[model samples]
Target: MHSFSTAVLALAASATVVLGHGHIRRVVVAGQTYPGFERWANTDQSNDVTWSFTTDNEGPIEAANVNTADIICHQNAKNAPKSVPVAAGSSLQVVRFNTQGGFEHPGPEMHYLASCGDSGCANVEKTSLRFFKIYEKGLVKGGMADDPDWNMQKWATTEVHKNVQPEGEGFIDTYTVHIPADIKPGNYVLRHEVMGLHRAHLGEAEFYPQCVNLEISGSGSQQPNGVNPMEMYHASDPGVALDIWVDLESYKIPGPAVSSVASKRDIESSPTLKTHARDIKHWLSKFMA
Candidate 1:
């Protein structure tokens, strides 16, 4: 049987990318990386990982790696949930982003702006439900547009939110994002929002807005000149992608032993580490049709 690769799918030429899910357990981990990130928890993505869970209406579960998550948290302990000491009823305010996944984005496309309070302020109304607007390309509005790139442009909800969940140890939020799956490879912001919170005891409502970025990339690529793998899969799988790879150990295409892409070939006839070319035309034809 011909071998194949089962690793995470990449539709770009780059090796790595990120998403902004700011799984911040602490606040200080948001603004920028420095000493503050070292105190409570390590924002270092050395170990912790993320997976995929989505459906047509609820869940289309898949164990795929996703872009990291970013959050708008308080800068005290590096994304820690445990509460810190406050001045009996004092005030603390700051703006920051906590990165959770892997995409290295340029920056947030939108911010949490409050209409009743102005730029960075919020209303202390009786029931603190706030209004928000989505900003894109430099235009501030409430809708989305299709970019020349196939990637998705804005937030799309399949079902209206009937209810909001109460806070757990900290803020508990959820969202439904729609990715075109054909957008240009790199980190792109998928979701952002401004939410209101009211402390009945203190009579203060805090707005915590958050954003999430996405990363789309190709598994690997080679120089010389050929079709972009990502483009081949932009709309349809387009059958098998064509590629040239040098294999020294013809017994197996080099990579992790488990990589299904590993192929067993005869070294004597093919030569070691020779740049051999092949095409996944079989798979491409189906998509083309």
Candidate 2:
């Protein structure tokens, strides 16, 4: 049980060998950029203690610390009290940064959501937080030649995973996810993360997680049935200590599966919805052409 301070000190001591790390700069909702850790920590209130430390201390959590308190949000930034208001069901984009170069880590990307108590964002407990998958992306093979399109469908019905280009280039990366329309209106935490398996062959997996606080407002009333956040993964879990070079197909994304209250019964009841969705895509393609 490594304390947050212990993890920070260890990370600082080995800062020289830390491959790369970054945080969510800001979240875009309805095309509006809201102040997140990066914005608040860099502004006139840069001296604010909660967010300031993140500017220099942002990075990946060691694979073995997945169960530590720091696992809640990278480096246990629990005191960084900041939350942005958003409408339920609104389109949301989490903007991420790739420290050294482009996103060179090859593995799946994922997003999870959890609710906080009425005591407000400031009093939310990280261990009490339970999350259900909202989005995930894994490898998708297209044609026989080299690379294939990995872009997912507009909205989501389950957890997803996608592949990161081994030779991609860029400092900034963006991933899209939506607030469950039926989600209860309240405060929540959006955990945006990526698991880099490049060094997994050596039994080391790197997790880059950035958490954003959000106050959602809408007519929705359903709550997510999620798993205990702390128990989501274990240090010795196959997914956490993996060998990406071998057994690629056997790899499974960590944490509980996505369970959208609104979509479950509907998707299950209307079998033709899948066909209709496919038809809509086909028609849209023809219309665009």
Candidate 3:
């Protein structure tokens, strides 16, 4: 069996040719980073903390499958075995690994949280978990006369890509979401997703959904009810079947509304992209040696 580091190195090497599709490589909470499930590598997930998927490719579920259980996370996703502790009212960064370039699709990004009751999130029935929206960012600005490129720069995906070094040459980018401050402390599943509307006009919008097990710590007392994943979206939803190539006046984010108790924060106006090529090269040298 290949070691974890070897698997990562192999995946990194292959990333140079893959395009469009991506997945969560890791997550950052309270300044500590936790590894995310690499669906394509090291499939012995007995010790994985992130939800598991059946496929090795980093692909998205089609909008046609929005009502299916696959939309709950990804394709044939299984519950994670462990939960990471996170403080309420703190930021959680979902770091993505884009295969060859920046996120090539234009879309909205969202975050949801579902409490796992007392038994915890590791093995809970996914369909029974009710998810309340904690964060949702759609089109920032566009459909104006003077603006060219359809204001793509203001898109949520664009903002995420800003985290990649050299604009479009790097493989890593991040999206930030905040845990609601008033939510009751307990085990919860953090569902982070992005919808690629580049081909939405053809009813082929792409949905990339991922889940993480979180054990929240706080002194709050609120457990808001939420919609089930199966009922959260529809094929004909305005946001799910829109045309971004044309002049769109605005966009309606798909799914349930953001919970009243959800925390809100401003995005960084100027984000710095840190380079990781040198580090990857160093690891490759050792592996080759």
Q: Judged by lDDT, which candidate is best?
A: 3
| Count of clashing pairs, candidate 3 | 0
Q: By TM-score, highest first, what's the ranking? A: 3, 2, 1
lDDT per prediction?
Answer: 0.21, 0.58, 0.74
Q: Which stretches of candidate 1 lie above 4 Å from their native place? A: 1-171, 189-191, 197-207, 211-213, 217-289
Question: What C-alpha lDDT, on a 0 to 100 scale, does residue 165 get in candidate 3?
Answer: 45
In the range 26-122, model 3's lDDT, one tens digit per residue, is 7888788887887656566555567877755677888889899999988899898877788888888888787567565667888898989877788
The candidate, 2 or 3, that scores higher on TM-score is 3
Clash pairs (backbone) in predicted model 2:
136-160, 136-161, 137-160, 137-161, 137-162, 138-161, 138-162
Candidate 2 yields a Cα-based lDDT of: 0.58
TM-score of candidate 3 against the unseen true structure: 0.79
Clash counts for the predictions, in order:
43, 7, 0
